[model samples]
Target: MARPGVPAPPPEPPRVGITLQQLRQSQGLSLDELSRKAGVSKSMLSQIERNQANPTVAVVWRLATALGVGVGELLGDGRPAPPAIVTVPAHGTPTLKSPDGKCELRILGPIDLAGEFEWYELTVQPGGALESEAHEPGSREHLSVLAGTLEVSAGSDTSRLKAGETARYAVDLPHAIRNTGKTIASALLVVLHAA
Candidate 1:
């Protein structure tokens, strides 16, 4: 309850689950068709839609890429999609969302498609998770935890990365980056592309 002089806190943000369904529907694809394209099980996809399951970042990325959308689209605000070519300035770049809803992403630089890979910084709030779906073929990712602790899940493996620790995994493996620590967390993600 708000005091007469104090204002009430903002309402909780809506939970974001399986915005993937929106992507699938927008693309006119059946769950099975999307399953085939994303290499995710239809049952799993169904669970994700219903919020019964949380897909790893790899799985999430793959689905988004198959749908030809940004990872944010799969984990999103359900807004109308804009044109191709998303240009984010040094100060105003779009974010890669965390499903746990406790983190904020800052896009620091341009996506260098000309190079073999790109990098981004992710700042995680206490109890936040960034579940990035899988990426396209031949792509991989490398992450280094900068502060606090993080839970890194890739494919069937899951590990905790403390400060200064790093791990690299295939982008096709459903992956998730989660802040398991009580304090704030940050990480550097290096995305590598396949030739």
Candidate 2:
């Protein structure tokens, strides 16, 4: 059913491509103003929009609130489609070996979360580690140990996450992931950001 002057609906946006940037710009906001209003770091918001990083739910909430939108607005209805999960291809296995020989993170789907953050699967070699330097503000993160054991260190606090165990924290926590058990370890990571 096409209207007289209206064209057919264009293809749907991939899950992550719908970022807050589009939403904010639609409302006529500048990055600096949005950062100040949302209380998130300007750099971080830029990263999220560029799909340069993943953000957490909490950070999503902040941006949404500041924008007068709902968290669902960020994740969207999964609609135009629906809540869907995408996996990486075998040939796409990441060549990003860990410098610490500890762990490697392979992004599973579109890092953009379309309005949210990117999600990934982290594979940690026994005694492996995941590290990253400080990033922009308004970024949130979550982790779930799917198989094996994972030791997560955030600042001065440490948490041992076991199989089927899950945890969520602020990306500002300055954390790292390590595998202490025998055998390879894997987990799911969801990152939300202002971008």
Name the regions of candidate 1 deviating beyond 4 angstroms.
1-94, 112-116
Which tens-of-lDDT digit does each residue in 1-195 have in candidate 2? Answer: 889999999965434325577678767899999999999899988887786766677888888889777677677743323224445577775445687756667766563453367777799988788876544576767899999998887667788999999987666657788888898889998877656
Residue lDDT tens for model 1, 1-195: 899999899975433354766667767899899899999999998988777887888987888888888777666775537545555566576676655568766655565553476777888897788776787777888889999999988888998989999988887767888887899988888888787
Against the true structure, candidate 2 has what lDDT?
0.75
Kindly give the stretch of ten consecutive residues in candidate 1 with the minimal lDDT sum.
Answer: 12-21
- Say which candidate scores most in lDDT: 1
> If scored against the real structure, what TM-score would every candidate get?
0.48, 0.50
> What are the candidates' C-alpha RMSDs?
23.8, 20.3
The TM-score, computed over Cα atoms with residue i paired to residue i, of candidate 2 is 0.50
